[model samples]
Target: MGAMVYWVILSLSILALGVWVFWSVRGVRAYVRARGKRLVTCPETHCAAAVELDAKGASWKAFRGGNYFRLQDCSRWPERQDCAQDCLQEIETLGQGCLVRTIVAGWYSGKTCVYCRKPLDKVEEWTGHMPALLDPDQKTVMWGEVPPEKLPGVFENYKPVCWSCHIAETFRRVHPELVTDRPPRW
Candidate 1:
Protein backbone atom coordinates (compact mmCIF):
# COMPACT_ATOMS: atom_id res chain seq x y z
CA MET A 1 0.00 0.00 0.00
CA GLY A 2 2.83 2.41 0.87
CA ALA A 3 4.58 1.69 -2.43
CA MET A 4 1.37 2.34 -4.42
CA VAL A 5 0.82 5.70 -2.68
CA TYR A 6 4.38 6.84 -3.53
CA TRP A 7 3.96 5.95 -7.23
CA VAL A 8 0.70 7.95 -7.46
CA ILE A 9 2.33 11.04 -5.92
CA LEU A 10 5.28 10.83 -8.33
CA SER A 11 2.95 10.57 -11.37
CA LEU A 12 0.99 13.66 -10.31
CA SER A 13 4.17 15.72 -9.92
CA ILE A 14 5.44 14.65 -13.37
CA LEU A 15 2.12 15.58 -14.99
CA ALA A 16 2.18 19.04 -13.41
CA LEU A 17 5.75 19.65 -14.61
CA GLY A 18 4.84 18.59 -18.14
CA VAL A 19 1.90 21.03 -18.19
CA TRP A 20 4.10 23.89 -17.07
CA VAL A 21 6.66 23.20 -19.77
CA PHE A 22 4.02 23.15 -22.49
CA TRP A 23 2.57 26.50 -21.40
CA SER A 24 6.00 28.08 -21.20
CA VAL A 25 6.89 27.03 -24.73
CA ARG A 26 3.59 28.32 -26.04
CA GLY A 27 4.10 31.74 -24.47
CA VAL A 28 7.65 32.08 -25.84
CA ARG A 29 6.49 31.29 -29.37
CA ALA A 30 3.76 33.92 -29.13
CA TYR A 31 6.21 36.58 -28.06
CA VAL A 32 8.54 35.88 -30.98
CA ARG A 33 5.80 35.93 -33.64
CA ALA A 34 4.34 39.19 -32.35
CA ARG A 35 7.64 40.98 -32.00
CA GLY A 36 8.23 43.78 -34.54
CA LYS A 37 8.01 47.56 -35.13
CA ARG A 38 4.84 49.28 -33.85
CA LEU A 39 3.36 52.73 -33.01
CA VAL A 40 0.92 53.79 -30.28
CA THR A 41 -0.58 56.87 -28.60
CA CYS A 42 -0.24 57.43 -24.83
CA PRO A 43 -4.03 56.82 -24.41
CA GLU A 44 -4.30 60.10 -22.50
CA THR A 45 -4.90 61.96 -25.86
CA HIS A 46 -2.48 64.88 -25.54
CA CYS A 47 1.12 64.34 -24.49
CA ALA A 48 4.60 63.58 -25.68
CA ALA A 49 5.86 60.14 -26.62
CA ALA A 50 5.78 57.28 -29.13
CA VAL A 51 5.92 54.02 -27.19
CA GLU A 52 6.89 50.63 -28.69
CA LEU A 53 6.10 47.37 -26.92
CA ASP A 54 6.56 43.57 -27.00
CA ALA A 55 3.39 41.81 -25.99
CA LYS A 56 1.75 38.42 -25.37
CA GLY A 57 -1.99 38.52 -25.96
CA ALA A 58 -4.60 39.03 -28.68
CA SER A 59 -3.48 41.57 -31.29
CA TRP A 60 -5.44 44.78 -31.96
CA LYS A 61 -5.78 47.64 -34.46
CA ALA A 62 -5.34 51.26 -33.41
CA PHE A 63 -8.23 53.51 -32.56
CA ARG A 64 -9.34 55.71 -35.46
CA GLY A 65 -8.79 59.17 -34.09
CA GLY A 66 -10.33 62.04 -36.07
CA ASN A 67 -6.97 63.72 -36.53
CA TYR A 68 -3.28 63.45 -35.78
CA PHE A 69 -3.59 66.17 -33.16
CA ARG A 70 -5.92 63.88 -31.23
CA LEU A 71 -3.48 61.01 -31.39
CA GLN A 72 -0.49 63.13 -30.34
CA ASP A 73 -0.05 66.67 -29.14
CA CYS A 74 1.66 68.70 -31.86
CA SER A 75 2.13 71.71 -29.61
CA ARG A 76 5.44 70.23 -28.44
CA TRP A 77 7.00 71.89 -31.46
CA PRO A 78 6.44 75.62 -31.31
CA GLU A 79 9.31 77.16 -33.20
CA ARG A 80 8.32 75.71 -36.59
CA GLN A 81 4.72 75.01 -35.57
CA ASP A 82 5.35 71.70 -37.30
CA CYS A 83 5.28 68.46 -35.38
CA ALA A 84 8.28 66.80 -36.99
CA GLN A 85 8.85 63.90 -34.65
CA ASP A 86 7.20 62.22 -31.70
CA CYS A 87 9.51 61.20 -28.91
CA LEU A 88 10.14 57.43 -29.25
CA GLN A 89 10.89 54.65 -26.72
CA GLU A 90 10.27 50.92 -26.28
CA ILE A 91 8.47 48.98 -23.55
CA GLU A 92 7.47 45.36 -23.04
CA THR A 93 3.68 45.12 -23.11
CA LEU A 94 2.08 42.91 -20.51
CA GLY A 95 -0.98 40.73 -21.28
CA GLN A 96 -1.86 43.09 -24.18
CA GLY A 97 -0.22 44.74 -27.16
CA CYS A 98 -0.35 48.53 -27.62
CA LEU A 99 0.48 49.35 -31.23
CA VAL A 100 -0.66 50.82 -34.53
CA ARG A 101 0.88 50.12 -37.90
CA THR A 102 2.87 53.07 -39.21
CA ILE A 103 3.19 53.91 -42.94
CA VAL A 104 6.94 53.16 -42.52
CA ALA A 105 8.10 56.33 -44.25
CA GLY A 106 8.21 59.38 -42.04
CA TRP A 107 8.84 59.69 -38.30
CA TYR A 108 5.11 59.39 -37.69
CA SER A 109 4.11 57.59 -40.86
CA GLY A 110 3.47 60.73 -42.91
CA LYS A 111 0.32 61.43 -40.98
CA THR A 112 0.87 65.14 -40.28
CA CYS A 113 2.71 67.80 -42.20
CA VAL A 114 5.98 68.88 -40.62
CA TYR A 115 5.49 72.45 -41.77
CA CYS A 116 1.86 73.58 -41.68
CA ARG A 117 -0.65 72.08 -39.29
CA LYS A 118 -2.47 70.35 -42.15
CA PRO A 119 -3.75 66.88 -42.92
CA LEU A 120 -1.26 64.68 -44.77
CA ASP A 121 -3.87 63.43 -47.23
CA LYS A 122 -4.40 66.90 -48.64
CA VAL A 123 -0.71 67.73 -48.94
CA GLU A 124 1.99 65.69 -50.60
CA GLU A 125 4.36 64.09 -48.08
CA TRP A 126 8.07 64.54 -48.69
CA THR A 127 10.79 62.59 -46.93
CA GLY A 128 13.33 65.28 -46.10
CA HIS A 129 16.74 64.05 -45.01
CA MET A 130 18.90 66.11 -42.67
CA PRO A 131 22.23 67.06 -44.14
CA ALA A 132 25.32 65.87 -42.22
CA LEU A 133 25.31 69.03 -40.10
CA LEU A 134 22.39 70.17 -37.97
CA ASP A 135 22.60 73.59 -39.52
CA PRO A 136 24.19 72.97 -42.89
CA ASP A 137 25.99 75.91 -44.45
CA GLN A 138 24.01 77.88 -47.00
CA LYS A 139 26.18 76.45 -49.77
CA THR A 140 25.46 72.83 -48.80
CA VAL A 141 21.73 73.48 -48.55
CA MET A 142 21.67 75.39 -51.79
CA TRP A 143 24.42 74.14 -54.07
CA GLY A 144 25.71 70.85 -52.67
CA GLU A 145 23.71 67.66 -52.86
CA VAL A 146 25.28 65.22 -50.44
CA PRO A 147 25.73 61.74 -51.97
CA PRO A 148 23.68 58.78 -50.67
CA GLU A 149 26.68 57.45 -48.73
CA LYS A 150 26.87 60.68 -46.79
CA LEU A 151 23.16 60.87 -46.12
CA PRO A 152 21.76 59.63 -42.78
CA GLY A 153 20.38 56.08 -42.60
CA VAL A 154 16.66 55.42 -43.10
CA PHE A 155 14.43 56.66 -40.28
CA GLU A 156 17.35 58.71 -39.00
CA ASN A 157 17.75 62.46 -39.25
CA TYR A 158 14.54 62.84 -41.26
CA LYS A 159 11.18 64.59 -41.20
CA PRO A 160 7.93 64.60 -43.17
CA VAL A 161 7.41 67.92 -44.90
CA CYS A 162 4.50 68.93 -47.09
CA TRP A 163 5.05 69.54 -50.81
CA SER A 164 4.79 73.32 -50.58
CA CYS A 165 7.12 73.59 -47.63
CA HIS A 166 9.42 70.97 -49.10
CA ILE A 167 9.76 72.81 -52.37
CA ALA A 168 10.27 76.07 -50.53
CA GLU A 169 12.82 74.62 -48.15
CA THR A 170 14.61 72.60 -50.81
CA PHE A 171 15.25 75.72 -52.79
CA ARG A 172 16.22 77.54 -49.63
CA ARG A 173 18.82 74.85 -48.90
CA VAL A 174 19.95 73.92 -52.40
CA HIS A 175 19.77 77.34 -54.05
CA PRO A 176 19.66 79.83 -51.25
CA GLU A 177 20.76 82.63 -53.55
CA LEU A 178 17.80 82.25 -55.92
CA VAL A 179 15.10 83.21 -53.39
CA THR A 180 16.78 85.04 -50.51
CA ASP A 181 16.93 88.47 -52.11
CA ARG A 182 13.42 88.28 -53.58
CA PRO A 183 10.75 89.47 -51.19
CA PRO A 184 7.53 87.41 -50.85
CA ARG A 185 4.73 88.79 -53.10
CA TRP A 186 2.34 89.72 -50.29
Candidate 2:
Protein backbone atom coordinates (compact mmCIF):
# COMPACT_ATOMS: atom_id res chain seq x y z
CA MET A 1 0.00 0.00 0.00
CA GLY A 2 2.83 2.49 0.81
CA ALA A 3 4.53 1.65 -2.54
CA MET A 4 1.36 2.45 -4.42
CA VAL A 5 0.93 5.72 -2.55
CA TYR A 6 4.50 6.73 -3.44
CA TRP A 7 3.95 5.95 -7.08
CA VAL A 8 0.77 8.00 -7.18
CA ILE A 9 2.56 10.99 -5.63
CA LEU A 10 5.31 10.78 -8.20
CA SER A 11 2.79 10.64 -10.99
CA LEU A 12 0.95 13.66 -9.64
CA SER A 13 4.18 15.64 -9.41
CA ILE A 14 5.05 14.79 -12.98
CA LEU A 15 1.62 15.82 -14.19
CA ALA A 16 1.81 19.11 -12.31
CA LEU A 17 5.22 19.85 -13.80
CA GLY A 18 3.95 19.15 -17.30
CA VAL A 19 0.97 21.40 -16.79
CA TRP A 20 3.18 24.21 -15.47
CA VAL A 21 5.54 23.98 -18.40
CA PHE A 22 2.74 23.95 -20.94
CA TRP A 23 1.13 27.04 -19.48
CA SER A 24 4.44 28.86 -19.27
CA VAL A 25 5.19 28.21 -22.91
CA ARG A 26 1.73 29.26 -24.06
CA GLY A 27 1.87 32.42 -21.97
CA VAL A 28 5.20 33.41 -23.47
CA ARG A 29 3.92 32.77 -26.97
CA ALA A 30 0.88 34.91 -26.36
CA TYR A 31 2.98 37.71 -24.91
CA VAL A 32 5.31 37.68 -27.90
CA ARG A 33 2.40 37.89 -30.30
CA ALA A 34 0.62 40.60 -28.38
CA ARG A 35 2.92 43.44 -29.33
CA GLY A 36 4.57 44.93 -32.43
CA LYS A 37 3.60 47.29 -35.23
CA ARG A 38 5.55 48.51 -38.22
CA LEU A 39 4.90 51.96 -39.53
CA VAL A 40 4.81 51.93 -43.32
CA THR A 41 4.24 54.65 -45.86
CA CYS A 42 2.52 53.94 -49.15
CA PRO A 43 4.36 55.61 -52.02
CA GLU A 44 1.81 55.03 -54.72
CA THR A 45 1.35 58.17 -56.73
CA HIS A 46 -2.39 57.83 -56.67
CA CYS A 47 -2.78 56.69 -53.09
CA ALA A 48 -0.12 57.93 -50.74
CA ALA A 49 -0.83 56.90 -47.18
CA ALA A 50 0.74 55.67 -43.97
CA VAL A 51 -0.47 52.58 -42.17
CA GLU A 52 0.75 50.75 -39.12
CA LEU A 53 1.30 47.07 -39.84
CA ASP A 54 0.79 44.23 -37.40
CA ALA A 55 4.21 42.83 -36.65
CA LYS A 56 2.86 39.37 -35.93
CA GLY A 57 1.28 39.16 -39.38
CA ALA A 58 3.09 37.94 -42.49
CA SER A 59 2.37 41.23 -44.23
CA TRP A 60 4.36 43.05 -41.57
CA LYS A 61 7.28 40.73 -42.13
CA ALA A 62 7.45 41.59 -45.81
CA PHE A 63 6.80 45.25 -45.12
CA ARG A 64 9.40 45.64 -42.43
CA GLY A 65 11.84 43.20 -44.00
CA GLY A 66 13.00 45.83 -46.45
CA ASN A 67 10.15 48.26 -45.99
CA TYR A 68 8.55 46.74 -49.09
CA PHE A 69 11.63 45.37 -50.75
CA ARG A 70 10.41 41.79 -50.89
CA LEU A 71 6.78 42.09 -49.80
CA GLN A 72 4.61 44.49 -51.72
CA ASP A 73 1.35 44.39 -49.81
CA CYS A 74 2.72 46.53 -47.01
CA SER A 75 1.72 50.00 -45.97
CA ARG A 76 4.67 51.50 -47.81
CA TRP A 77 3.42 50.44 -51.23
CA PRO A 78 0.48 48.13 -50.99
CA GLU A 79 -0.07 48.28 -54.73
CA ARG A 80 2.93 45.99 -55.20
CA GLN A 81 1.05 43.19 -53.45
CA ASP A 82 1.16 41.00 -56.54
CA CYS A 83 4.95 41.02 -56.92
CA ALA A 84 6.79 37.72 -56.64
CA GLN A 85 9.25 39.20 -54.17
CA ASP A 86 6.53 40.10 -51.71
CA CYS A 87 5.87 36.61 -50.43
CA LEU A 88 9.25 35.03 -51.19
CA GLN A 89 11.30 37.50 -49.15
CA GLU A 90 12.23 36.57 -45.63
CA ILE A 91 10.42 38.41 -42.88
CA GLU A 92 12.39 40.75 -40.63
CA THR A 93 10.87 40.41 -37.21
CA LEU A 94 10.86 43.68 -35.31
CA GLY A 95 12.77 44.13 -32.09
CA GLN A 96 14.60 46.83 -30.17
CA GLY A 97 16.70 47.76 -33.19
CA CYS A 98 13.68 48.67 -35.29
CA LEU A 99 11.89 50.39 -32.45
CA VAL A 100 14.75 52.61 -31.28
CA ARG A 101 15.56 53.75 -34.80
CA THR A 102 12.00 54.78 -35.55
CA ILE A 103 11.85 56.59 -32.24
CA VAL A 104 15.08 58.39 -33.07
CA ALA A 105 13.72 59.43 -36.45
CA GLY A 106 10.82 61.11 -34.71
CA TRP A 107 13.00 62.76 -32.07
CA TYR A 108 15.63 63.86 -34.57
CA SER A 109 15.18 64.93 -38.15
CA GLY A 110 12.83 63.34 -40.67
CA LYS A 111 12.42 66.23 -43.07
CA THR A 112 15.74 65.96 -44.91
CA CYS A 113 18.25 63.48 -46.21
CA VAL A 114 21.19 63.01 -43.87
CA TYR A 115 23.60 62.03 -46.65
CA CYS A 116 22.73 64.59 -49.34
CA ARG A 117 21.37 67.19 -46.91
CA LYS A 118 18.47 67.89 -49.26
CA PRO A 119 14.87 68.47 -48.33
CA LEU A 120 12.92 65.25 -48.70
CA ASP A 121 9.99 66.08 -50.90
CA LYS A 122 7.83 63.19 -49.81
CA VAL A 123 5.73 63.27 -52.93
CA GLU A 124 8.72 62.95 -55.21
CA GLU A 125 11.53 61.65 -53.02
CA TRP A 126 11.70 58.20 -51.56
CA THR A 127 13.62 57.67 -48.34
CA GLY A 128 15.43 54.87 -46.57
CA HIS A 129 17.57 54.21 -43.51
CA MET A 130 21.16 53.11 -43.08
CA PRO A 131 22.41 52.42 -39.59
CA ALA A 132 25.19 54.75 -38.52
CA LEU A 133 28.63 53.20 -38.56
CA LEU A 134 29.99 53.08 -35.04
CA ASP A 135 33.57 52.58 -36.18
CA PRO A 136 34.64 54.90 -38.97
CA ASP A 137 37.24 52.34 -40.03
CA GLN A 138 34.69 49.55 -40.22
CA LYS A 139 34.21 50.44 -43.96
CA THR A 140 30.51 49.61 -43.97
CA VAL A 141 27.35 49.60 -41.93
CA MET A 142 25.20 46.49 -41.71
CA TRP A 143 22.03 47.41 -39.86
CA GLY A 144 21.18 43.80 -39.19
CA GLU A 145 24.52 43.25 -37.52
CA VAL A 146 24.02 46.15 -35.14
CA PRO A 147 23.55 44.70 -31.71
CA PRO A 148 20.15 45.46 -30.21
CA GLU A 149 21.60 46.15 -26.77
CA LYS A 150 23.66 49.02 -28.19
CA LEU A 151 20.73 50.70 -29.94
CA PRO A 152 19.52 52.51 -26.83
CA GLY A 153 22.81 54.35 -26.53
CA VAL A 154 23.06 55.32 -30.20
CA PHE A 155 19.65 56.63 -31.03
CA GLU A 156 21.26 59.61 -32.77
CA ASN A 157 23.36 57.33 -34.92
CA TYR A 158 20.56 56.23 -37.23
CA LYS A 159 20.67 58.25 -40.43
CA PRO A 160 17.82 59.08 -42.74
CA VAL A 161 18.92 58.49 -46.30
CA CYS A 162 17.02 59.32 -49.42
CA TRP A 163 16.60 56.51 -51.93
CA SER A 164 19.18 57.94 -54.34
CA CYS A 165 21.88 58.25 -51.71
CA HIS A 166 20.91 54.97 -50.08
CA ILE A 167 21.56 53.19 -53.39
CA ALA A 168 24.90 54.90 -53.87
CA GLU A 169 26.04 54.48 -50.28
CA THR A 170 24.99 50.85 -50.14
CA PHE A 171 26.84 50.13 -53.38
CA ARG A 172 29.88 52.10 -52.31
CA ARG A 173 30.06 50.33 -48.99
CA VAL A 174 29.55 46.93 -50.58
CA HIS A 175 31.81 47.57 -53.57
CA PRO A 176 34.21 50.37 -52.76
CA GLU A 177 36.22 50.01 -55.97
CA LEU A 178 33.15 50.62 -58.15
CA VAL A 179 32.50 54.16 -56.97
CA THR A 180 35.40 56.48 -57.54
CA ASP A 181 33.90 59.94 -57.27
CA ARG A 182 31.62 60.68 -54.35
CA PRO A 183 28.30 62.40 -54.83
CA PRO A 184 28.74 66.17 -54.52
CA ARG A 185 26.87 66.12 -51.22
CA TRP A 186 29.02 63.41 -49.77
Q: Rate the local accuracy (lDDT) of all candidates.
A: 0.40, 0.45
Model 1: lDDT equals: 0.40
What's the C-alpha lDDT at position 69 in model 1?
15
Best by TM-score: 2
lDDT of 1 by residue, 58-116 (tens): 12221111111112222222442344333332223321233322223323443554556
List the candidate 1 regions with Cα displacement exceeding 4 Å.
39-51, 54-186
List, residue by residue over 9-51, the lDDT tens digit for candidate 2. Answer: 9999999999877655654553344333333222333232222
lDDT: worst 10-residue window of model 1: 62-71
Q: Alpha-carbon error at 170 in model 2, in Å?
A: 2.9
TM-score of 2: 0.33
Which model scores highest in lDDT?
A: 2
Per-prediction TM-score: 0.28, 0.33
